[model samples]
Target: MTLSKKIEHLEQVLNQPAENFANSFKSDIILFFDDNFSENNTQLFFLNDLNSKEEIQSWVEILTSRFVMKFEAEFEAENDFINDYLENG
Candidate 1:
């Protein structure tokens, strides 16, 4: 079916509630809404927020550092220590 027809069908089936649906996508978060339609539009809003980035960076730094220390202790630099440690674990 055509897109418009499908949307219309959804409206009928759902009884058309005036609300927004929002969610996150890994690095991006979005909210679906329509202001111009003043009716209903399935729109996407990407959120560029610092909190998520900070948290992710913090996790990576924490995990990588923890792994690196164990790696260095177990294998010397002459070996492919870093790569091998990660791959083996």
Candidate 2:
């Protein structure tokens, strides 16, 4: 798949509900990267031809940072809800 298509797929996967936050999210993200690079040699070649290692690393870092922020926000929201419930109940 093209880079845009891969990104689109990633966004779709990210939007899906995770059954278990830790296992499901980690595995799904890993699987997405693995399938794109390892299983699809063409995509690996395309990336190599189009971008340098640093550029690719930067992209990965950006995505990772975004995921971290999202996870932190979700965790905080859940924690707040639980605390409020305990206090009120």
Candidate of highest TM-score: 2
Report the error of model 1 at residue 16, Å: 44
Put down candidate 2 lDDT per residue, 1-89, tens digits, no spaces: 45655444444444556554342443434454454434343433334332444554444444444444454653455334323322342
Can you tell me which runs of candidate 2 are displaced by over 4 Å? 1-28, 34-36, 39-50, 71-89
The superposed Cα distance between candidate 1 and the true structure at residue 64, in angstroms, equals 1.1
Superposed on all Cα atoms, the candidates' RMSDs to the truth, in angstroms, are 18.9, 13.7
Residue 71 lDDT in model 2? 46
Task: Please report, as a residue range, the 10-residue window in candidate 1 with the lowest summed lDDT.
Answer: 22-31
How well does candidate 1 match the true structure in TM-score terms? 0.23
TM-score of every candidate = 0.23, 0.35
Each prediction's whole-model lDDT (CA): 0.30, 0.43
What's the lDDT for residue 16 in model 2?
A: 51
Which pairs in model 1 have colliding backbones? Answer: none
